[model samples]
Target: MDSRSSDVSARQERGETGGWISTPVTTDLLRGALDLEHTEHGALPHRLPARARAQCSDGQLAMAEAQPSGVRLVLRTRATAVELDTLPTKVAYRGAPPGPDGVYDLLVDGHLVARTSVTGGNLRTVDMTTGSVETRTGPVGTARFSGLSAEPKELEIWLPHNEITQLVELRADAPVEAVPDRGRQVWLHHGSSISHGSDAASPTTTWPALAAFRGGVELINLGLGGSALLDPFTARALRDTPAELISVKLGINLVNADLMRLRAFTPAVHGFLDTVREGHPSTPLLVVSPIHCPIHEDTPGPSVPDFGDFEAGKLTFRAGGDPAERAAGKLTLNVIREELSRIVKQRAAEDPNLHHLDGRELYGEADTAELPLPDRLHPDAATHRRIGERFAERIFGTGGPFAARDD
Candidate 1:
C-alpha cells in the first residue's frame, strides 16, 4: 500500500474522531447549489429546487442536476488535515471499461492544494444501445486531505462534476465555521452539457468555474447536461435565484435533441428571457448562441452516438438529420444563432441590459483545428480553460456586459 493509504488505514483503525471535530453540512457552507435534499445517507445537493425538479421527469436532467457540477463546501478553519465522507454514485457503460473514480479537489485560500478520489461507492451500469440501467449499492468512502498550512484560512472542497455525491460528514482537526461572504458579484449561468463540464479535468476547472474565478464572482451553475432545453421550470428557477450577472448558452442541446423547430424556437428563447426579466429586469443578461460545432453547423440534428469503436472503448457523436431538413424549419446551429441575435437585438431596444454573444467568439473554426472536441460534442480540459478565459475577457473585462461598476 502507498503511504497515503497506510495513513488512512491507520486513521480508520484509530477511529474517525481521533482528535477530529465534526461540522454539520448546512446551506451556509455550500455554494453553487440551489437546494439540498436530506437523504437516507446524507445531504444531496440539487441545482434545481424541488418544485422545478417535480415539473420535469427527464432522467438525464435528474442525473445532471444531481451531479453537483460546481457545488463545493466552503468553510473557515485552521485545520492542517480534513476529511469528507461521501457516497458517490458513479456511472459505467456496460460494454466499456469502468471509468476512473470521481475526483475531490481541496483548495486552500482559493488555490488548489490536494486532489483525491474515493473508492467502493454505488455503481450505476448503463446499457447505451437498449436505454436501460442497473444500479448496485456500495459502501461510503472518505476523501482525506492532509499536511496543510494550519493557519486560519478558507478552504473549499469541490465535489466531482460528473458523479452524484451525497455529502455525509465533515471531520477536521480544527473547528470549522461558515466563511463570511466576500462581497463578490453572483453569476448565475445556464446552458447545456458543454457548460455542464462533461469532460472537465476536475470540478473547479470546468469552464463556468474557471470563468467565475477569473471574474471574481460567486457562481450558481445551472448547466444541466442533455437538458438545457429551455424548459419553463429552468427559467423559473433562474428567475427565483438571486444574481447580479446572468447568461444562458443555448442551441446545441436543442438541435442535438431535435426538440424544436424554428416556429417554436424563437418564441421559446423570448419566453425564457421574459421569465428571467420578471425577476431581474435590469441585471446584465447575456444570451450566448451555440459554440462552433461543425457537425451541426448547417445540418439539423438528433445527434446519435457512433458505436463503431465500442469494442475499442471509444464513443463519438454524429448528426443524424439531413441538411435538406432546413427547408422544413428544422433548427441548426447557424439558424439558431441568427434567431438568437435577432431576438436579442429586438429585446435590447427596450431592455438596455440585454446583450447577445455569438458562441463562436468563444470557440470558432480556428480552435477546432487545435483543440478538436473529442466526442464532437463536449470540449476537452484544455478547451474548457480556453473558453473560460475568453468568456472572462469578453463578458467581465472593460466595458463588457457584466463589467464591474462603481455606484
Candidate 2:
C-alpha cells in the first residue's frame, strides 16, 4: 500500500477519515491475494520442540511467538516446480523456523495441509547485519513441510512459543483494501513480549502497534519473545531500517538472560546505540527498561518460569534463586535497576537525542501487586493496554521522545 493511502487509512481509524478509499476485504476479492490475518479471537502460544529446550539454540532460546494466517492461491512458475522436487506445480505450505521449536499450521486454499513450527515470517524485505551481509531476506532454514507443490504460495501462521488456548478465530487471506501512497513515517520497535503483545488481546493491540496508531506511522515489530538479547546484529538491523521513531526496550531481556554483570551490560548498551547512531545518526531513540516483574523486584536472580510447573499444567515463574540462594548469589532486582539507571543517565549525557524510561514507571511494585504475569515473566493483555496507555502519555505529543527532532 502507498503512504498516501496509509495516512488516509490512519486518519479513518482515528475518525479523521476522508480523501481516502476505505474498503473492507471480501471473501471473493480476498481469494485473489496471498496473505494471512491473525485470528481475531485471542493470544496463542507456540509449542516449542524438545530439541529447543535441550540444545538452547539461539534461535530456540530467543523464541518469537507468531501465528500463521494460512496460505492462499498458489501460482506456480516452471522453475520453482523443479527446484524442491515436490509435486509438479502443486501448492506447498510448510514452516521451518530456525532451531526447529515452534510449529506453524499450513493450509492450502483453506484446506489444512500440514502443521509445523519451524517456519519464520517471510522476508518481504531484507535486513542488514553488523558485519555487512546485505541480503534481501531472513536466513533460510530447511522446511519440514511436505508433498505440497512449491509454486507461488501464501501461508499464514500463529507464532507463539507455548500454547494456543488464547487463539481466537483464525483468519486467512481476507481482502485487505489499502489506500494509495502518501509520504509517512514508519516506526520500528524492538523489545520483549510487551512490545510483541505478550498480553495484548490481538496482534494490533500491542503497545508499539497502539503507539503507532496514535502517532500515525507504519509499524515493523521486531519483537522477539526471548530474542531481544541486545545482539549487535539486531542493532544493525535497526540502524539500517528507515524508521521515523526507534526504541529499544532493554531491561527485562537482559535481566532474564542474566547474560552479563553490570560491568559488561553498561558498555554493551552504549555500543549498541552507538552502532545505531552510525546509521541513524540523529533519529530519535528511546531506551525502555523492563516493566514490573516481582521475581526481579528487589533482587535480580536467574529468572525463568518453572517448566515442571508448566508441564504439570501450571504456569508459574520460580525465581531460579530461592531466598537462600538469592542471599548467597548477591543477585537482586536492585542491582539490575541501579545499573539500568546508570546506563540511561550516562547515555543521555552523551547523546541528547537518546532517552530512557525505567520499566517500573510503566508497571512498578505497586502495579505488580495488582497485575502479575501468568508465568511471572510476561504480562497479560490487560497489562499490555495499561503499558501502551502509559507509554503514549509519556512518549507521544510534541515535546516527547517520539515527537523529538531527527537532527
Candidate 3:
C-alpha cells in the first residue's frame, strides 16, 4: 500500500477515529418485509400495526420475526441484549404497555416517566391480530433521557408473545443532527390527518417534519389520522411535554370525524389551552384551523369517495355534519376560525405568548381551487411541501426560527 494508505491505517490502528467507518455493520441493516402479528388468548388473531409509533415510543419484544421472509423465532433465551447499549441521546421510552390491552407503564430508569392510552385508539385502521410492521402512534416530539441509568426496564406489548405474536419493524433510532448547534427551542404540534401524513409521500416529507427540519428545531408531532378530536389525554400530553413553541392544527379531522360541534369545541379548546399554559406559562402557542378543502371548506363534516379518495363527487360531507355533533355546535371552517381566534385571544390575555394561525392562510379555498387534498381528508406530497414552505416563512420567518444552528 502507498505511504498515505499506510499512514491512515496507522492512525486507525492507533485508535484515532470519530467518524463513520467505511464498512457499516450490515448484519442489522438487512432489508426485508417485517410484520408483527397479534394474538388473542395466546394465538394469532390479526396483523400488527402498519404505521410507526413516535420516536420516544420505540419498543422491543421478547420475540420477533427475523429479517428473512417468514422465519420467526422466540428470542427469550436465544436473543442477546445490548448491556448498557448506547441509545440515541434525544430518545427515550415514553409509554410501554406492561399489562393486557397492550399497555405498558413508561419508565426512565424506574421513574414513571410517561403513561399512554392503550391500543384503545389504534383499532380503527390498525390490525392488532395480524403480523405487520405498522406505524400505529403519533408523530415525533421533543424529549431527553438526559440521565438514564443502565437498568434494563421491561416493556410489554398488547400482543401475547407465547402465542404467534411477534414484534416487527424493530427500530432503534439514533437521533441525527439536523441542526449543528442551537438554543434547542423545541416545537410541540397537534393536528389532524394532514399533520399525520396519512398520504404524504414519506415520513420526513410530512409538513411538520419538514417545517421542523427547516426551522432547525426538535418536534413532537401528535398528528393522528382521524383522532384529532381534542381529547383530554392528548391535551394533557401537550401540557406535560416541554416546548418553547407550540401549535395545534384543528378542523379537517373534526369535520370528518363528526365528533363534536361548536359549543364543545370552544370549551374543549379552552381547556386544552388552559392545560397547555399551565405547563408553558409563556411559551409561544399557535392554534391553526383547517387548510383549504373545498367540500369541507364551505361545508362541515368530511366524507370521501372511499376511505382514501376525495376529488370525485362521490366524495361529499355527511348531511351537514351530524345534528347531535352539530348540536354540540356547527363546527364549520367559519366556526373553527371564529372560535379558535376567540379561544387563543382568551388565553393570550393571561399569557401574552399565545398566538393563532388560520389554516386558510396556509392553504385557503382559493389555494384549494388550484390544489386540493387528494383524498378529501389527506393532502398530497406537494401540499405538504407547500405547507412547510408557508409555515417556515410565516411562523419561523427569515430569522430562521427563534433557535438556529450556530455557524
Candidate 4:
C-alpha cells in the first residue's frame, strides 16, 4: 500500500482520525533562531531576542534579523507529506521589478529533497534612493512537500533567508515530533548580507549553512545583513547563545554604512568581543575580516546604490566616500582587515581558544576575476558554494582551529 494508505490504516487501528495532524510551531521545532515572538498570526523567528531588538530602532536591523537566514523547522515523522503555512514579507525596489520569490528548501535526513516558494503574503516596497519603505498586506500561503518514505525520518524545512517569514502552521499526515539531539557541535556565526544568504540559491546553500553541513555541526546563523555593525546587543545575543564554536565576520557593513571611523571601529570591535567572551569565555571563537570587494578595498564607503539600470531592473553599488578620507581615519576594508588581524593576535596571546581567519582566503582578488559579484557587492550563488567549501577545509579540517579533538 502507498504511504498515505498506510497512514490511514495506522490511524484507523489507533482509533484516531486520518486527517492531517497539526503541530505547534514552537522553539522545540525551530533551529538557528535565538528567539521566537508570538505574533498575531503565528510565530516569527528573530536572530536577536526581544531585549536586544528593543535596544535598536533601525528598521534595517529589524527586517534583517527577522529574515531567518539559517533558520529551519526540524522534526521526525513517518508522514509521506508535509505542509507549512507561512506569511512571507518580500522586499521590492521602488522602480525595479520585484526580484524572484524567496526559496524554501526541504531536506530529508540531511539531503536536499525539494525546493519551493510561497506566493501571496506581504510586500515591502523600498525607495532605495530615499531609504523609505511602504508595506502592503497579503494572504498567507502554504508550502507543501510530498512523496516521502513511510518510515520514520528527520525532516528540515529551511525557511527563506531573504524574506521575513511568520510561520503560521505545520501539518503532516502522520504525527511529528522534535528530532532528538544528534550530538553535533553547534556553530554560531555572525556576519553581513553575504552570510545572510543574499543572492544565495537557497537557505541551506548560504555559505555558513553549507559550511555547517560540511563540518557536521548544527548552525545558528546571526548573519543580519546590513546590520552587522558590531552592536553591543548583538554581541550579548551571541554571548548568551549556546554554542561549541563561534565566528564573527566583520567590516563590509561598517564600511558600506560609513557607521564609524577607525577610532570608533577599533574600540567597538574590542567591546563586542569582550562582551561575548564574558559568556563564552573559552569557546573556539574565530574572528574573520571582510572578504574582497574591490570598490571598498581601498576606497571608503557609504556605498550608494547605482540605479542607472533601474529601468532594466538591475541594481549595483558603488563606493561614495573619498579615498583621501582614509588618511583622516575613515575605515576601509584593508584597514579593517589589518586591525582585525592585530586585535586577534593581541587577544590570542592571552586567550588560547581565540583564532583568526583572513576573509580573502575564502574569496580573494584571484577568485573575483572568474566569479565576479553580480551586484558589485554580494557574491553570487556559485561564489557562495566556493566560499562554503573553502571555509569547511580551512576551519574544520585537520589542524584547523575548529578541528575535532581526540578527547
Using TM-score, give the best candidate's number: 1
Residue 367 in model 1: shift from native, Å? 0.9
The 10-residue segment with the lowest total lDDT in model 3: 82-91
Question: Which lDDT tens digits does candidate 2 get at residues 113-165?
Answer: 66543232223211111212121222222223435554444432223223212
Compose the digit string of candidate 1's lDDT tens values, residues 281-392: 9999999999999999999999998998876787789999999999999999999999999999999999999999999999999999999999899999999999999999
Candidate 4 per-residue C-alpha lDDT over 110-172 given as tens digits, one digit per residue, 9 for 90 to 100: 999999999888999999979899999987777889899999899999999999999988989
Candidate that beats the other on lDDT, 1 or 2, i.e. the better one:
1
Q: Which segments of candidate 2 are over 4 A away from where they belong? A: 1-57, 61-181, 307-312, 322-332, 404-407
Task: Give the per-residue Cα lDDT of candidate 1 at 127.
Answer: 91
Top lDDT hit: 4
What would the TM-scores of all predictions be? Answer: 0.97, 0.58, 0.55, 0.95
Cα error, residue 360 of model 4, in Å, equals 0.6
- Scanning candidate 2 in windows of ten residues, the lowest lDDT window is 81-90
Backbone clashes in each candidate structure, one number apiece? 0, 45, 29, 0
Question: Candidates sorted by lDDT, descending order?
Answer: 4, 1, 2, 3
- Stretches of model 3 off by over 4 angstroms after superposition: 1-183, 302-328, 399-407
Cα lDDT of model 3 by residue, 1-407, tens digit: 73334434754795643332221212122111223333221112211123322212322211111111111111111111111111010111112222222212223321344332212222112222242334333211111122323333322111111122222222112211111223656777777657755445544556876787678665556665556677665676677766778888987767775677676777788887788778877777788888877666546664533322232222322324443444446666766787788877776777776777888778877776677665455667788898987897888875433434355
- How does model 2 score by TM-score? 0.58
